[model samples]
Target: MSGRKTGALLVLVLLALLGACSPAPECSSHQDCPPGQLCLSNRCQPGSPADGAADAGADPGRDAGADPGSDGADAGADPAGDAGADAGADAGADTGADPGADAAGDTGADAGDEAADSGPGDCLDPDGDGYGTGTSCLGPDCAPDDAERHPGAPELCNGLDDDCDGVPDQGGVCPQANPYLWVFLLAGQSNMVGLGVNSELGGADASGVNNVHIFCDLSVHNDGNPHCLHWVTPLVPGFGVLPDRFGPELSFGRRLHELWPNRSLAIIKIAEGGTALADRWAARDGDLYQLLVQQVTTQMNDLHIAWSPRLVAFVWMQGESDACSSDTANAYYLNLRNFIQALRQDLGVDLLPITAGLIADQPMWPEAGKVRDATSLLADHLGPMDVVETTDLPRHPDDLAHYDTAGQLELGRRFAEAVNALLADRDWEFPGDFSRAQGDGFWRYQACQGASCSLLSWDLFRRYWKNASATVLIGDGWVQPAESQAAEISWWAPWDGRIQVTASAVLAASGGDGTMVSIFRNERLLAGPRPLTAGSGASFDLLLDVEQGQRLRFITDSGSTADGELDRTTWQITVHMSRVAGD
Candidate 1:
């Protein structure tokens, strides 16, 4: 047969097949059909190939055995038409098409609809913690059980990272109240009340001056006493009673302000002149103590109202009046302890850091030695306590007792140092060499003759004990020890370091017996046992490495029983210990 005739016959057969198999119009492409119809296998379909086949097969004219508009297919025809319709519907649904659509459409809502039906893992955050749990979702929450535990949560001190930013307690606990500032409590007597002449502070320069706010409530005293419970920038002369006097607060506030420029400094000064710890500043019974507590509470409330502040430390500098009497001086330790405990109780914090200045030596006050002893005892026994020494500080020429302007300035600097050390959790040590003059003067001593030892206080030895066998007396700038007696002085080592100890004294033996002077480190002999004879002077210089908390002992032993003696003429005994090196 010819090629043209064969092609015409094939086209006629295809047209016949289309007319019988499909009820839709016949076309070469999809554009030839109605607006929504698509051409498939030369048939104009309503949707796609699968949709047209299903609809065409459902017609009773095309399938003789099948009912019109019925879902069932003809018995003799392939069952794939119904299967193809089911597959097309599933594909449309999986691809985010409307379920009612005949075939898979171009809409992207299928996955979203499935996620909405499944719940939680979708973009929906049920916990409201700004995080989602599903792997396919936008925000994946690692821990959905705890609402507090989420991405970008705040880290607190409760041993948990509330905001899951991969750090635990990074920023510390958030303050419950705002306007947080640092507070300092200034208490005690005269020196604390600005006994120093204000004119002396002319040369002292405080770097950051504007950050300090002092709250003074001298209402208990006369109106002229700078009594106001309002915040004011600290000024030298105004901080005290008279405009010409100033206390340690000026330098203290200035230094603190300089150290923490970003933080606000608040000083609550509650001090008065000539107040003794036994009476005026007594913990429970004293009027001043009660008044101090009241003022602190009232001012603290006012401070909170104005600007919330955190109470950091308490600075105390009293006890001069106690130095005037033996009874008050003796009880200074207990009185100071009670006052501190009461202050902490009133403030509601038991472990408040207390930095106190030791009472300076008063030539007119005979019992000053006792007060000094009590102050040392307090520093040694109390926790979170620091003592700044003022024994060597020069007194103001005018008052003859109060610290001079230079002394007050130095005292204020020391107070700041001690407070700063407390905040940093470190020890504050007095610089320079420590010297104990008069042998039995600055130290507590116990003398023994053949295992019988008696503790001789610093005051008693200065008063009596010239004839006793174990008596050691300091007179005319000399130390005199009787026969067969050993005098020992012990103190706590301030720092861990190598110390150079030097001791010198003139000695004389009654029956030609030699005398020996020794230095011991916690009972272990480090230097001395140097022999002494009549008209011979004993002297020893030794270097020893020591640690803090170690006890050091300096002892003088008369070698012969009832026969040896130390000369009183040119007989000064001095023990000086200086830190040479180490830390």
Candidate 2:
């Protein structure tokens, strides 16, 4: 036959063989077909481009079957999968070699919430530590195949993040001598378990901060230790009750670092949403209270062996829940006092400097004032204690009780400052009782149109005047001048001699002309009339000589546009001095 005819004859024979075979059936998904068929173009065809190896990251069951969904639902054979595992619903449920997980049976991964799709490896944890083994384990665990190599574990000579503090091998000598970790303990309800979104944080803040660490229980009401967290990780956003949200810890830790950059800081936080101090945080038989005790004790115990762990501060931001209940509000003072005492006892620290944030006076809780009063009274009784005033702190526009991101950050800064002051032990003058400084007292709040300023009553100073914002104390007790007028917070020099002045200011308006902030010794200008634009700020540190009974004032003027209307200037002024030569 001719070459063409022979080709046709062979083609005819191939056609005949093809016609004898059964037609491929249509399929919506891989599950709709039997083994040996691929759902291609809606048809169960003979060849599947995707084999079991392609789904190696699927649930630890019989991943040999190519299942696109469910935990190892495929029964089809996968020659390419690691360890001849069956993905069958029954017989193939476990990895044939080592149960559901990889060969070592310890990768802490679920089909949900884990990174997927890498070629099969151990990914299992052979040891009992709550982390997976192998490099491909659930987290960024170096030496994942080894149980002794997780975060917070003792730093071995292994070139890994043995302590799991982002750096491998202690970031230096194996657990260097006196790696003193400055510890801060945080306790409270939803406010402490902050609701601020991570995305709201600026630049590098969205990632973990260096040298600052966090170990927290983000869950609510769990009796034992919480899960899904490392022993300790670089302090990052998402340590709040919500996995992706963060609390004041971010700001608090960062501020502490800013204040004393050389010290290594760690924050151990355990907080829940909507928890009450009178009940949930009571010193007696409180589950959360007990858990807080356990977590802190456990952390201290764990670190004390190899680290010089110093508990520097205890910060509390509770009471909103209590504020909603009359009985809780009434009992708040004693409850808080006992709670602090018990925490001190359990943590084995006495007279620890404590800072608690006062709930904002909002309509969410009618008894909020009672709780605030209790905090004030508690402070009077507890010598090394202080309160953070938050009445004017901003909250989410849509939520009455919850603080927004900016509010959360400010709360942290205030807590840091309070703790810093207690530790400094200087007779510096600021608002230790952070509740608004009495207008009738040394710190006076007043308003001015141009140069003529008159003091307003505390009530007028706290409330809007002339249909505009008043000169008021805001988050962390920073005073903000009104948008419609220049404002002043004046103080009388208590002694004669050189005085150290530390002050800062930031624009605090949604939209505005900037403001000119000035500090004057009576009529003598000391600093500023310096301009501050939106989201921008200036800090002043000065040593000025003054006579006793001098009228010193921190003042804000309208911006260069000279329009005081809608220019919000927020500032803090602190004065520190020694007694003059003979009082």
Candidate 3:
């Protein structure tokens, strides 16, 4: 064989070896690779012209050669001046992640990389809200700089769309921390749910009673299992069993709104028509009572966090089912008591105010005498409770068990009145007929007419009253029963100066809302209507300016709700009339 033929044979063998070692094509187009990656030599690569989208807004002109891998961002003002990084290697989309690379330019920026875990990522999550912006690392965060705005975030009452749901403030009002916004719970059986026709009760509530929010889950049937009837709405007429039917919550909520027009109201009404206190609402696990607490827990999750709303009242209109049988009716009192006890325990409100309605002695549930008696006797002068007389309220003529339009409406009003009475009874006040002049100042007691005090003597104040010395051993004030209007007990300023009045009062029984104790300088109102719930006494601490003979009055008043017979309060007002600077 010739030497030339032998050399050519060797060349052919080397070409065959190189062809066998070559890799397969990795990508075909820009779409075939990650955002920052490009198709170079049929392989998905980065930092080259193929990865143009990732290099957007970057200076493309090349200058100084750079290191292979760079953890630094935007090394210089100009892309070419980036001697710290490789040629045209942008913080935007170019880096050298490959182990082996030449110093001429960066291999590429990882399209889906967190750049040294600082300042760079597949997405520009600067706010760290798990969202970002930019063409290479596009994200759901419309406001990339803000951490609060994102998908599925809770919509705040702020002007922005916190949840990224297009519209802002969709989840309800923001900073729902208004203490005056009272929440009431309405529960019970068929009568409580009500079967009155909407047409018979004035159709739909088109005007939408203001500030009254309702969350109802009455979809459950006689089986007593809770249903997923999740929805929150402004108070409408047809929130009954059917969309066309009306219930007690309508008038109950409305009456409350009317009575306390200045403040807002809300309700959590969970009921079933045929449930029995002894069975369905047994206060045990997996029952209607559990459903009530569970649903309410979820519903009020935001409310409790935001507004710190109070559960002011619980109105119950039930007992027809238990009344159907003598055994249940006989055990009604104990069972009912246990139910209330369990509710208060679960809700963590031991001093919960309740308005229980008497079961009607209608033909539908004729053996209701025991149940009726139990309801009435639950609050035997041990207040924070009131009873609505349902036995007298008219029932549906045909059904004999359910309340007709008028009956249902009246029932609701009565429930509201009963609740009002209970709350009013806790409002403490100074007695007008009881007072004395001691030392250089006169300690006088009076009832507040509306919000102001003209110093009128009421029969209630005259009948149930005690002087400050008799009420509290340390203070010079008055002890009197709470009435519809707030009561005032003022002390004449012995000398002109700034004084601190530390006043406090206590209702003999539980259940209270609103400013129990407040202070005023002469006729000018000063600090507080300090709200105190439960057995905790209401108190006030105020530093006020007073004239030499000005009236520094300590006032206590329940809102307007006529019956406050049970609001017997002990009063104490200590005035530190003499104080040095900073003392």
RMSD (Cα, Å) for all candidates, in order, is 34.8, 30.0, 27.3
Clashes in model 1: which pairs?
A: 96-110, 153-163, 153-164, 154-163, 194-246, 194-247
Tens digits of per-residue lDDT, candidate 2, 219-329, equal 543333342245556677777656667789988988888887877788988888888987777895799899888888888778877665667679999899999979999
Alpha carbon lDDT at 574, candidate 2: 71
lDDT of 3: 0.54
Q: What is the TM-score of each predicted model, taking all chains together?
A: 0.46, 0.43, 0.45
Error of 1 at 259 (Å): 2.2
- For candidate 3, the 10 contiguous residues with the lowest summed lDDT are 101-110
Top lDDT model: 2
CA lDDT, every model vs. true structure: 0.54, 0.59, 0.54
The lDDT-based order of candidates, best leading, equals 2, 3, 1
User: In order, how many clashes per candidate?
Assistant: 6, 11, 7
lDDT of 1 at 396: 70
Question: Between the candidate structures 1 and 3, which one is better when assessed by TM-score?
Answer: 1
Candidate 1 lDDT tens digits, 474-578: 333344556655655544333233444445555643454656655544333334455566766654443333333344455666555534233332223332334
